[model samples]
Structures are given as structure tokens and as C-alpha cells.
Target: MAKSPFRWIGRLTKPVLIACVIGFFSAFGLADRIAGFSANLGEKDRMVRWSAVLSGATRDAIPVTLIDIDPSTMAALGHPQSAPREVLAGLLSLAAAKHASGIFLDMDTSRPGSPAGDAALAAVLAAYPPDAPPLALARRLGAADQAGNTINALAEQASVLDAAVRGKPNVIWAASVSRIDEDRVVRRWQLSHTTCAPGPGATLPSPQLFAAAVASAHPRPLSDLNAFADSRTQTACAPGTAAASPPAWPRNPDQRAAIAFLIPDGPDLAAPQFITRDGRRVPLFRRMPARALMSASGAVVSPQAVADDLLRDRFVIIGASHAESLDGHLTPIGFLPGALIVANAVATAPAVLSGQPVGPLGATLIALALLGALVAITSRLRPLAAALAVAVAVLAALMALGRIFAPSTASDIVLAALGMVAFLSTIEGIHAIGKDWRARGWRALLKPEKPPAAQPTETIT
Candidate 1:
């Protein structure tokens, strides 16, 4: 008797089912830990980093700059740990006069400074006109800075943060807390946060809000903080404008505004210069020493001269970038100061708002489709041919995904391809072995009976 040709199909049943399960889990992020377990295959975080890095520089220069509180600036200011409050006040005053789009000071003023200096800073901030470009002040978030009253309170504390804005109603207090990923890297960004405060409206916004506000002030509206924060897309301008309106984003109150790091880290972990659209080689965000913004006496440069050279409508972020300052955070572009991180975050607003961020759904569907196609193709070939063909095909698919899609999506495609291969191989292996087993069973079933012959022989004896 001949073996049933359908036996191979039965053998493939179990492996096919297992493969489907694996594919489903991988698609939904359930298999992330397992996939990440193998370094060569599991680099989800690195992929995320790569996606941002490959995003490349913007078509136009982002109108943002950073003022690093470097060693020289510290020496010039006659302060080691912190710049005097008066010096900062002078910076702010000059920036306001220069008509800067926004000024973000990334410092914790929770502790009181010299009484006279604090007063002078407050006076300068108060004297600014209501229509002055918005100023965002920062307060370091700690475990104590929760919803209820704690040590980080605004009232009980004689804080410079509060003193800096004593009579300045226009200044917005932005929480400087950053969300660190499980891998200890700052990838996601928070657009806004509600910090408990002492004022009538006792809530402080996130520094991202200030950045968005600055972006909104672009000659051509590039971003809308309120709409962007709420995850709603809004029309930014009329037809035929140079800027495109940002797409509507889904609202997430927890504020997981993921950072889009434009710069890529080199072998030295330093950001290398890239040629810009204008043919100039420059880093993503240019860093200027704080002293450059001031004079020999630590006074801010005259508004006319400063505007002519720098700070004319540019969004400026002032933060300590000195290595000992330890104000830097781990990012995809390597260890960078929070100020640069903030600038990168701001830089991505245009693209994110335009809804150009990578899409995983499309990639996932494509991978699954390719998996089906692979199964069909391999089923017709011999086992050896199937393995070689599938391997080559999966490699091709993985390359296409990595080059054409976001890194995360490409990784997903890779996992899907793995699942497809596992499924197909298991089926083929089982089919090959089952063919022999089925043949043996058929031979046993068809073998002629010897009982009759044995009975005749016994009778003759």
C-alpha cells in the first residue's frame, strides 16, 4: 500500500500554529524582552536610537541656540557652582530687549540667593512689558515635588525661583523633570506637566510648553502648543504656505512626547557636523558660551549689538554644560546637557507636528504579508532549497525594512521574518520525518498475514 500524500500537511499543523503565536506576540510588543535577550537580534532600544539618528537634520536650521555655562564663563563670573542671579537677570533683560522668541533658563532656583541680587532680578523681570516674548523658568523636580505640600513647595520655601518672578505675571514656571526610559536613556519627552504651586492657579507647565510657544511664534506658524499638547491637529495657515500644518496627535495626559534626536553619535560619542541645506557644516544645535552673551563686567551685551549678532528672535536655552555641572543626560546622541536635549526636542516639533514620525502599524502588516508569501514559496521547494530561499528572502525583507521604515518597525519586521522561518522549518522538518514513519505504518498494515500458514504447519506436524 502507498502512503497517504496528505500526511505531510498533518505533520505541519503543530509548528504552523506555534509560529503564528510567536508572530502575534512579536507584533504587539509582548516578545520584546525575549527578542531583546539576544544582543544581535534584540536591540530594540538601539533601534529606537537609530531611528532618531537616521531622521537626519532638518531642511532648514532650527531657530534655537544653547548658552553653556562653561568653565570660562564660571571663572569670568567669579562663581564656581552657580552664576550670580544678577548676571542671569542681565541676560534675561538683554534677551527681552533683543526680542528673543523665547528664553528658557534650565536651572533650579529652589534655594535663595543673595537678597539684593534676588531683588534686582525680580525687578528686571517685573519691568518687562506684557507683550515681551515669553520667559520660562525652571524648578528641578525631585521625589518631594509631588501634588501635595512637601519640601519642594513654592510658599514655605524662600526660593529664588519664586523670587525671580516675584512681580512678573508673564513668566511661566516650567517643570524641568525628564522621564528616563527603563534603559536609563532620555528618549520620550513630556510636552507639559502639572506641578503643584502656591499661586491662585497652582500648577506649573512643562518646559516643552515654552519651546512649543516659541515655535508657534515663527513668522510662519510651525507649532501650536495648546493643540499639540492636547494631541489635536490644527490648521496652521492658509493654502500655499511654506509651512505645513502638523497632524492631529492622540491625546496622552501623562505627556509622553518622545524626543526625536536629530544628531547621530560618532565613534567618540561626539556629534559630528553634517552639511546643511545651505551647504554649511554644523552640528544640530550650536552651543554658545554664556560669556559671549555678556560683557567684561558680566553685564549683558547691549540690545542693539546683541540683536545684530545673536539672539534676534532665536529661542535660547541657558543651562550649565560644564562636565562637572552634571546637568547632562544620556541620550541617543550620547551624553548631552539637558539644554541640548531640550533644543533637540524643540527642533523635532515641526516634523512631529507634521505627523512624519515613523509608523509601526504599516511595517507590521507588511512583515506579516511577507511571511505568508514566504510560506507559500517554500511549500513548493525541497527542504534545502526552501531553507536557502527563505533565508535569502528574509534577509532582503529585513534590509528593505531597515532602509525604508523606522528602526523600530524594521526590527518588528525582522522578528516577523524569524517567526516565519521558524514556522516553515518546523513544518518541513516534521513533514520529512513523518514521511518515513507513515511509510512504516503502511507496510505493517499491508503485510500479508502468516497465521493461516502457521496453523497448516502445526496440523501437518
Candidate 2:
């Protein structure tokens, strides 16, 4: 029984072909269509989020906000000529008044400094106090002293972190865990991680180090604290993958397990709330008024938001989420909104408290879905149809998720819309460039005559 030649061509269409290829790559985590993830929440309808939190849109219900240094701040900071340190210090002070959960210094302090400027900022940080503190402050409990709060003392001791408050014990630093992608984009970033100390004990990334520094500020004696995650896990990851390093353990037993204990948990993890800095609100992407951010003196606030949150017992993560600034990462659904990073962090904090990780598999699945969907659209469907399908799928998926979970749909919607556009463009590009070379050749057979090439000299000679 011989098969018919035409049977070979039974099922070939743009959609199916592309979808198959896309699905295969997605399953393997190698979709290469997207440019990369972004951290910009300045775009309309986006929120920021970061990791150390659990799952994706499913867990997006959590609330963390972007204390943006927007145009308003820019104006207050004095454009290009004036000093920015004063402005930053003022913002910190203002947020403190608003009772912000905690302030994470998302900005890089390594840069932007002069002796005078650094001293000014350090003085401000030293003034604030922490909810809890080291023995130094603890010893000073009954004894009166003309110094800042416990937060200020600890922040001051965090000289490696930059500068500090002189007598305060509650200040802390915050940094990001940036990850690179195939496309050379900083798509996914981690708020914390475990790493080798490196030769000569090179320091860990800022986020983890800063977190460690903050966790150490507490009065809990190291002897009573149970630290973990520093030990190497015996388990091996999958083939070609690097082994998972253990996370840093805090000296405080409760915090040795997680940072949630660093401060008391107050608001519902998912409540949509933002800290109103200095009783003034900034446009989501813009900044608030100068007067609102400033103290009667040239200084910003009487006390930083750090003092307020810690003194009041709150959770804070002072980190930046500026996408145009390339200060963001790729998340499960795609790249996360900067605002969403804060949300993800707060959401994941519970898991850390409970010792329940959302599992790498969940994030893996999201990346796979995005990659697969893109390849499918780009390879198979018509440009217009693929685009429409992608948009619809993204919207439907986000809406569906949002209906049950809080804002869990943002990533899905964003990725889907992007993939749809990509796939459509790729398909159109392929078609527009021309295809079916075999068919074109076949048409040549119907030509009247061939333009003959010169023949070799006759061998008969």
C-alpha cells in the first residue's frame, strides 16, 4: 500500500505551523520573540511588583506602591543644576510623615554624592528611630540621651550602606536582584537571593545585603536567633540549570525565617492603599508639591517615613521601579509593572513567614506561556488575526483572573497584547518578504525561452 504524494500536504496553514513551533519552544522555555521585560509603571493602568513574594497575577492582589520621583520631584530638586540629595532626603522625611510602611532605597547610593551632600542626608537618616533595635539602643532604654531613635543608630552603623543616622537604630537600605535575558534586556530582577561569598568574600547584591543589614538592626540576641538558608541545599536542580543557593538567614529567629517579622503586619496584604507623603499625593507617575514635601526649614520632614513606619510598626520596602530608567525586571506573565513588584513582594512575604515558596515551577510556567504564545502567533496566524487573537486572549485571561484574584490579570493582559503584536508582525514580515520559492520556480517552467549561458568548448575539438 503506497501513500499518495498529495497526502504529504494534508494539513499546512500559517496558524498551525506557527503554533506548533511556538508550543514546543515554550514547553522548553526558549521563546525568543519578545524584546524583554520592562519596569516602567508610568504607562497608564499599571502597578509595580517585586519578588520574595509568591506567585504571579494569582498573587497580584497584594499592595505595594511606587513612591515615584516624578516631574514634581524633579522640579523641587532644582532641575539639572541644583542638588538632588536635599530633594531625596526631603522625600524620605515627607513619606515618614505619611506613615509609609517602610522606605526601601531603590536608588543606587554609590553614585550621587559629595561630602557635604552625603553628610546632610546622613544626618536626616540618623534622626529617625526604629520600632526595635540593637542592644546599644536597648541599653539606653531607661537612660535619657539627646540622640535620634533606634532606627537612626542602626542606619548610622550601616556606613557600608552609605551614611547613617547618628543615634538612630531603625534605618535600613533596599536594593534589587537584577537578571539578564537572552535579548540583553534586564527582564527579571530578584529582591533577594543566595550567592557564593565569591573569592575574598565579595559582597552579595545590594537587596540581600541591605536586607541582612536591616534584619541585624533588631535587639534580639544572636544566640536566641535561629539562622538558616546560608547552608548549601543537598538537592540538585534539573540538567543544565544552576543549583539554587540558600537565602541569607537573619540573626533574629523569627526574621531568620523571614523579614515579615522585621515589622508588624498591619494592612490586608492586598488592600489598594498608598502612603500619602506629607499629607500630599503625587500623580501616580508624577511628583507631589515641594511645600508638601518640605519642612518649614530647608529640610524635608521633621522625621523620615522610616521613623513613622517603624515607630508605628509597619512593613516597608524602599526600592525604585523606574522602567525608562531600566530599573525593572521580567515577571511570570512577562515583565512586571514596577508598581506590581511591590505588590508581589508583599504577597510573597506571607509565604516567607509560613515557609511556603510559590515554587519556581509557577514562574517557569508563566515564562513558558508567554514564550509559547508568542511563537504561535508569530509563526502561524495572519498578522491581523494573530494580533486580534492575542489581544482577546490577554484581555480574557486577565479579566478572568482579576474576577477571582485581585489584579492578577495585568501580566497576562500585557504579555498577550505584546505577543499578539509581535506574532502578527512576524507573519506579515515573512509574507511580505515573499515565500513559496518552489512555486515561483515552477512558474519559470512556463517561460517562453531560457536565457542561455555560454557552453563549454566542444570536446570534439
Candidate 3:
């Protein structure tokens, strides 16, 4: 007998119902909450860590260098709470002399230092040549008040240093902050921070971002960098000229980008190594001892040839790596120095600018497609086989998503996997209930068999 055309609709009813339910959850953000829970459990971090491991170290030459202030350097410099201003000035002078492309001093200069040291640092800043590479000094912001106003004590700088570079176009005060996740792992780098100030408001870019902005080969304007900041909020801080109060500092919702770690933390700093996926050795960033750059008298210690090769035309970041410095944070690979984190961020800057391989909408679509495909493929298998299929599909999706999108959309992949599992289980449950109902002849309550469709009785007496 010819089948009814409407039978196809009956066949599609269950799948359509499942799709609608999944779509509802996704649209209303329940899926996001599920993803958040997964992230809080470290699933997202694991995906990111594996992604970095599988992708391997960057092939291109690293354009950044770290001047590490390790224990030895700190002991040599008297282990002050802060790196001495004089020592920093000497390092700056050495880098400038070697034609470094840009320099970021990651040490906090929020308080006063010895008078002589301050004077020496100020002199170096004032004497910086017009043609010298741009300099970025780390500026720390005080805790925000109830109204979101922060106190940026200009006193954080040695009074002398502040005076020398107050209005210098080449000198920039950039924010040096990292976003530490709830698990205490530092996975993201906040690009810029805009806050209300007592005088004119201020905007500060992270050191990594500032380095990217002032890159010598292809310098980008400060305005260009704004595109990377949190687009949901106003990134521009208006001047407080009119006696009216400035707007409250907007919450930085999307200012941060996931850091793509190129090198894992090494146990041996003396002989650090990084091997890529293809078994090739690569350096993510060059590291040098701060002491190698200058002496107690602020005279260059390393030979000109060595210094030139190390510093010339490179973005240099000077930060402490000593254990006592308490500047280390947990990362995907392991506990690493904050300087290394900054270096990784600098390495990952290009990727951040390139953006996620797929955006939220695209990711959602991909996830839904993956779910639909999983459901279609697994429905025909035995229960155990179906479970295994689901597992394999979820694993494959996660790996691919992590490799292409990194941590930015890892949570979505996880959420999709979870939804698929729930969906399959619900389908199975419904089928089981239907089977039991028919076995017990309980289907009569819903819809009677209609006496076998009233089959004609052609039998004669």
C-alpha cells in the first residue's frame, strides 16, 4: 500500500521537539551557565593547555626579550622591595644605546625612592634622545571607590621621573595587570583599562598592548588599539572639564583576551628549553639577566656586540623573576613568573588582534550542527555503542574547537557536548517509557487501536 505523505512529519516530530528544547536553553543562556560551571571545574583550561601543547611553539622568531631580575640580580642590587630606580635607569640607558625598538618597565614606581637614585633615573629620562624608541612605565591604580573613581597617585613615580616625562609624547603610562581566573590561573590579558581620575580622566593599555602599538616595523596608533578593548563599554575616558562629575568607570566586560602560551614553565631557568610539536626547538622570547646590561656605576657590562644582538630593535620587558619577589602566577602549563606571562602576552598579541577563529554566533551554529550530527549518527547504535560514539564525537569536537578557537570558545564546545548527552538520554527515556506503556497495554488510555482499523469482514456463513 502507498504510504501517507504526512508520515514524514510523524517521523520528524521527536527530533524537532528535541531541537526546540535545546534551542530554547541556548537562547535563554542556560547553556552558558552550564558552560560556566564546566569552566569553573577547569575543563576550559585543560582544553587550552592541550591546544597550546599540540599546536607547539611559534615558528617565527620572537621579537620580544625579557630582562629578568632574578635572585642573583636582586641580591646584587640589595633586594629592595622595588628595583632601585638607579639600576633601572642604567638598564634603560643601555637599551636606548643599543637602539631597542620599545621598552616596558614592568616594575611598579608608585612610591618614592632614594633621592640620588630618583635623580639618576630622571636624568636618563630627560636625556632620552628624540629619536629613541618609545618608553612605557607601569602605572598602578588604587582600589576603586564606591563610585568607581580610582586614585592614580602621581607620587607613584619618583617626583623627578614624573617631572621629566610628564608631557613627553614618547613616554606612556600603561597599565600592567593580568586577569587571574577564580582558580588562580592567569589565562587572559586585559588590553586596556579606562578609569576616572581626579583631574582629566585616563586610559591605560597593558604593557603587551603598548609594545604592539609602538612596534617599530608597523606601528599602530593609540586609536587603533582601542578596537581591542571592551567593545561593550565606553573605552574612551572623557576629560572632567565641566564641573559636572564624570561617568562612573565602566566595568571591563570584554577587555581581556586569552593568552596563548608559547613556552611552558621550566624547572631549570639556567637551561630552559621548549620543543615544538614537530620536534623542533624554538625560543618564544629571549631572556637576559638584568645585571648583564649594566654595573653599579651604570656602565655597560655586556660587550657592544652582544648587547646589540640582544637588544637592538627588540621590544624589551624588564621585570622581576626572583622567587622572593612574589611575582609568579599559576598558568596552564605551570607556575610561571609574571614577566614570562607578560612575554607570552606579547607573543600572543598578533593572535589577539586576529581574533577568535569563530565568533559567538558562528560558534553557536557550529555547536548546534555538531549536536545534530551526533544525534543522527548515534541514534541507530546499541546503547553502549551509542555512548561510545557520543564520547568520541565530543572529544573530537573539543580538540578541533580548542585548536582553532583557543580558550575563547572552549566553553561553548563543552556546553554543546553536555546538551547532546542530555538530549540523547531524554530520547532514550521517552522510548523506554513508551515501550513499557505498550507492553502493559496502557496505550489504550491515550489512543485505542481502533479495532484494527475496522478490517472488512468478507467471511460468509
On lDDT, the leading prediction is: 3
For 183-231, candidate 1 gives per-residue lDDT tens digits of: 8988777655442333322334566555654543343322334444223
Which candidate should be chosen as best, given TM-score against the real structure? 3
Question: Judged by TM-score relative to the true structure, which candidate is superior, 2 or 3?
Answer: 3
List per-prediction Cα lDDT, in the order shown.
0.61, 0.39, 0.66
**Candidate 3, residues 351-374: lDDT per residue as tens digits?**
344334555677678877887878
Which prediction has more favorable lDDT, 1 or 2? 1
Q: Judge candidate 1 against the unseen true structure and give its global Cα lDDT, from 0 to 1.
A: 0.61
Each model's TM-score? 0.60, 0.40, 0.66
Clashing pairs in 1: 189-257, 233-248, 246-353
Model 3 residue runs over 4 Å out of place are 1-43, 53-62, 145-160, 221-223, 226-254, 267-282, 294-307, 356-362, 374-407, 410-461
What would the TM-score be for candidate 2 when compared with the true structure? 0.40
- lDDT-sorted candidate list, best first: 3, 1, 2
